[model samples]
Target: MALMITDECINCDVCEPECPNGAISQGDETYVIDPALCTECVGHYETSQCVEVCPVDCIVKDPSHDESEDDLRAKFERIAGN
Candidate 1:
């Protein structure tokens, strides 16, 4: 599944740079994760960097964009131009 930054985000600015897929960005209020670009770091790291660095633990699996590990890997490959 993709990840999402909830309203609980503290805007600490830590998660943005940690996203390997460039999926996290500063939204109008809180940081937002683009489901289209999010791969949960499947092809990059063992864990989601943004989630690891998030201070508030606001990042969570996006139930609305639920995907399997294979799906995430494919998405990551696409993003990486593989």
Candidate 2:
């Protein structure tokens, strides 16, 4: 599943650069992750970098975009063009 940023986000900006997929962006109040671009770092890293860098632990999975690992890998490959 794709990850999302919760209201608990302090807008610390730490998680933005950590996201290898470039899915995280500045939202109205907090950083938000684009579900379409989010692959949980499956093809890039062992874990979600945004969640890993978020100090407040605000990054969580988006149940709405629930997808299997194969789907995530496809998304990653599509974004990476490989």
Candidate 3:
């Protein structure tokens, strides 16, 4: 499943670089995760890197972009051009 940054994000700028898929960005208000580019770090790491680095625990699953493990892997492969 894709992840999202909640309003609680403090713009700590910690999670953005940790995203393997380069899905996280600085939005108008806070960091936002691009669902199309997000793969929950399936192909890069065992867990979501952004979540692991986030200090406020504001990153959470994006319900509107729910996807299974296989789907996430596929996304990773596709986005990575592998």
Candidate 4:
């Protein structure tokens, strides 16, 4: 599944640069995660780099954008053109 940034985000700016897919960005009020571009770092890393580095632990699976492992990998490949 894709990940999302919660309201708990402190706008620390740590998570944005950690996202391999460039899915995280600063929003009007807080950091936001783009489900369309998110691949949970499946193809780039064993774990989500953004989540791994977020000090606030505000990143979580996007329930609304739930996806299987295969789906996530497909999304990664689609983004990577692999």
lDDT of all predictions, in order shown? Answer: 0.92, 0.91, 0.92, 0.92
Error of 2 at 32 (Å): 0.4
Residue-level lDDT tens digits of model 1 in 1-82: 9999999998999988988788988999999999999999998899999989987889999999989999999998888999
RMSD of each: 0.6, 0.7, 0.6, 0.6
| TM-score for each of the candidates | 0.97, 0.96, 0.97, 0.97
In candidate 2 the C-alpha lDDT for residue 10 amounts to 93
lDDT by residue (1-82, candidate 2, tens digit) is: 9998889999888988888888989988888999999999999899888888888998999999999999999999999999
lDDT of 3 by residue, 1-82 (tens): 7999999999999998898778999999999999999998999999998989888999999999989999999988889888
Show pairs that collide, candidate 3: none
The segments of candidate 1 whose C-alpha lies over 4 angstroms from its true place after superposition are none
Q: Which stretches of candidate 3 lie over 4 Å from their true place?
A: none
Candidate 2: which pairs clash? none
Name the runs in model 4 displaced over 4 angstroms. none
What is the TM-score (0 to 1) of candidate 3? 0.97
Residue by residue across 1-82, what tens digits does model 4's lDDT show?
A: 8999889999988989988899988899999999999999998899899989999899999999989999999998999999
